[model samples]
Target: MNALPALPDSPGAYRWFYADVTAGEYSAVFIFMVGSLFSPRYSARVKRGALPLEHCAVNFALYHRGVSRRWVLSEYPQASVLRQGRELRIGRSRLEYAPDGTVRMEVDERCAPLGKAVRARLVLEPQVPAAEELQLVPGLPHFWRALAPRAKARLDVLSEDVSVEGIGYHDGNHGAELLGARLPRWHWARVHGPEETVVDYHLPDGVAPLRVTAGVLGTKSERRPLLSEARPTSLTGWGLRVPAQLYSGNTVVGTPRLLESSPFYARVEARRDGLDVMGEVADFRRFHSPFIRWMAHFRTRVERAA
Candidate 1:
């Protein structure tokens, strides 16, 4: 029931499915973008009436102890994308929304820039499934859904010759306008506790943050007061601002570690109280800058054929 709806064929319309798994020392995240929301090309061509479906992409990243181990963001020709019901395939990677209610991901991709092969498979069985659709921004066309808040997961990295079991998560996002055109910036975090998982979305638009917790059999979602940082925010080498310290109520979330850092996006992890968190702070608007868009190309591989 959580599979994405049929995509819009409008020039700026897009949809993507995202899944992440954390197993012991290994954590992996992947995104299948039908309209390529993060694509600089998409940002550039939208005004020219470029079809979002014509710029499909797949992004995969592996992390170990808060450091990037492998990364791939490949853009392929529209002809390379295949969709059969709730199942989708772009290039060599595939995602299946099965009739049995399990989600499966199979990836065979080359790490960006380096071109080293990274292959993996992940099966996620949802223990807590989120059913409602949400507005990513107030009165915006962007929609967000958490398909699985907590799942029993198994991840196998075939090329790396590794396998492990851990907790996993899945979500879907889609919108009618270019991402940068709809929202300026945002911070999102997912923290997993022994008995619960909480995902928070912080958008500084004079609105309370959206906080969702999956603890028992289902989930509790509400508007939460913004978190206060203990210390002043710090700037990254690329000039992005991030919290120096974070607190969940009276308790600190722990020291944050950088997993991936770039000019417009960052992924970090923090641990304490047996809680594991993965957070992302992004500036979609900055991606529209000519310089930033130019820098984005080196990290993305263009696959012209299936």
Candidate 2:
């Protein structure tokens, strides 16, 4: 409906970072984030001169064959300062940003809960210039910046010395604000085609009074707005929906196949207007606290979507 909001003048005031890598029919998602709320409760605490309240969390997940192994660490660090940077470290794992605009990531097996040791080292190189920062709300309080929408990745992963090397797709996002506070629900998907990459976000009526859809198509020489109509369809097991098609006016441009589905997300392989698509889409509601979901008037049960 309405045009997306302008960029926030002070995006640096908050803290967040996310990086995702997918290769050889498997994918990894990593996130480091700090969220602050300035609600009446927080304001009252501030009036009483209480310490600032915030939440910090780190999440790393690996997905393959309808199975996911995730490590989540969350805490409320009282009187601790939160900072944002190109480098992030949690436990034995680390993600670093290099001078050449590449991101290097290393994860230790100790972070995983069970099974043999799983270790990884990956280098992500951007294939196109960064997309313009997009402000999701009117004040740009929270935004999504697609870095390396299409990337070439070199990865070496070992599970008890068994190693695999392959190329993959890389993308990232940085934002400020409690996601649940900003929108009730949304669907996001990225397609890494042979010659290009396409990314899309669909904010349904629950996220806002009006439906909002935004996306980008990235090629070797340029990144442009995706003028096609894209939406999720074909509900699979566990209620996961796949990105059914991309359309230019009334003409179909692409179609996608469900590759994997979990409790709150799904990965797909798509063919869009002659370009191949491989990516994932997620619904955050499933990840929220049970109480929060009840308060938000949304209902979800924890189940294996695979």
Candidate 3:
């Protein structure tokens, strides 16, 4: 496996895997608290399989507005490795792999600025005859493609309210010794009472072109574009409520609830601004690899205000 290109530590977002076997759905979501430089959070869940299982995860990423601190709890099972060093905080925790093959995880963000807890359990029985190998995209970058079919997201965040852009790629062998390789960036916004969502993402071609693919996901009743046609929207939300994020310790989580007409249902709240993000997921999946460890090395400070 080759090494993945370095992702800027300044501001970015990522996701974990959770297949709902109990609900007979394929479900997963990614959060992009892009440091409020672009406040964003993405969620998605799909129902397709027969046997039902909840896809769950507990993960968090830490970054200071202007401080040079960066740390994240990635990877699961065995000793939960804590990737920290370069101006960042860190820790290590273990997970509970159920006898039924369900994956349960717990992440605690303490003594830090921003913290969160996520719980996801994906159950895939593979009962139905295998569909034409729906081209499984390996690596962290392109993994979202697998979930794209059942995905419906709202990007209401960007550098500014201009046409946002991004791309998604797929690859069988992304040369990632530890994980798969993928690169994507987009802008999104909500329309009319937040009932409608739109996004524009870019997936560059070159390294893993074919393995790399891009598409847009929308409401179940509507047809989403496999490739975007309109420019991405620059949507922003999260007023003052944004704080230096942190995660740590025992927390409470409510049963995942599906938002009306939305693809996401689970919600976990940890401490954000001296207040607790109540009902936040506590245990989800995480990955610890060389790239993640490198990223965990430093803290990123927010840009200075004029």
Candidate 4:
């Protein structure tokens, strides 16, 4: 058989944040995805183009602390297109709405088709309130920075140089789900700037040890660690913590099964002083784009080094 056209295969993760600004407080969520169906033989890839609807599930729950009458503003779809003097440069994406009222985003790097690299951008509407100030960490890396109104956030991981700028949102009016969890076609995300750190978690049932991945990218520096033997058991207000549980996955172990998943809320402790940091985790809405999956058929690489 004639060799098929080359398809790009790359692994990366996505981070998402949700918050309620009208209520004076908010929550954050991060998701890390590795491997793809195009190549590298990803088990998570849906068979016969079947969408792994379960894996695509994105749900967040927020607890009100200081404010009451908390509610979500609007769930819309946004697209970030780069242009230079009326000419499209690169970068594009579509957000989706899941049945659980959670949001999912399918990002596409269009520059690949034109033989260029694309940087993904997250666009928030002006109607959405933004933090008024920045919170500077004392001892962490110089790049770490924090901002107020921590409602929604997302992370775009790229192996090559990419730019994230000039992002804007569009209306996501996709129909609702009747039952179970359906993939999101569009979404709305809150904005919290500077950046903190990247985190990694490994479920005992993970396919590979080093394959466990998670992280936070600040405006300055990025933190990423391989989760050796860890998994996020449960999540509560202010933080998502890892709990002790039974992890089942082995060559002789047959298929991995959850004997018991420990329950624990999210809590941020001072890595140095062992102090609990104040925070919250809440549910917001977003959408996924069919365009993202279409663009994934191709891959883009950075300009070669000198």
Best by lDDT: 1
lDDT of each: 0.80, 0.47, 0.21, 0.22
lDDT of 3: 0.21
Give the poorly placed runs of model 4, Cα more than 4 Å off. 1-25, 30-45, 51-62, 66-198, 205-306
Least well predicted 10-residue stretch by lDDT in candidate 3 = 34-43
Candidates sorted by TM-score, descending order? 1, 2, 3, 4
Which wins on TM-score, candidate 1 or candidate 3?
Answer: 1
Q: 188-247 in candidate 3: lDDT tens per residue? A: 111111122121122233222112112232322222234433222211131111112222
CA error at residue 249 for candidate 3, angstroms = 38
* Residue-wise C-alpha lDDT for candidate 1, range 1-306, written one tens digit per residue: 535468668888888888888889899998888888668898788899999778998898888777787898988767232344767778888888877789988888888756899898989999886747778777888877778888899999888887999999888888888877868888887878888888877786666678778868688777776656434678888999876755554457976677888899988787776777887888988888989989999899888757
Among these predicted structures, which one has the highest TM-score? 1
lDDT of 4 by residue, 1-306 (tens): 011111112222111222222212222122111111121122223333322121221121222332211111111111122221111111133343323322333334323324333333232332222222111122211110121122243323242332232212111111112110222111112222233221111212222211111114212222224346444444333232333222222111111111111121122211112111222221111102234333333332222211
Model 3: runs farther than 4 Å from truth? 1-58, 61-92, 111-228, 235-306
Give residue 99's error in model 2 in angstroms. 1.1
TM-score of 2: 0.61
The runs of at least 3 residues in candidate 1 whose Cα sits more than 4 Å from the true structure, single-residue gaps closed, are: 79-84, 226-232, 246-250
Q: Model 2 — which ten-residue stretch has the worst lDDT?
A: 297-306
Q: What global local distance difference test value does model 4 have?
A: 0.22
Across 1-306, the per-residue lDDT of candidate 2 in tens digits comes to: 011121112212234455666556556665544432211222223324433223333445565532555443332332122123445554455667676778676765334223344576767777676666665544535556665666677656654232333334444444443344444445555555455555655554423311122224433222234435444477767676655764333345566555545555565654444444445566655535454334322211111111
Q: What does each candidate score in C-alpha RMSD?
A: 2.0, 8.7, 18.4, 18.8
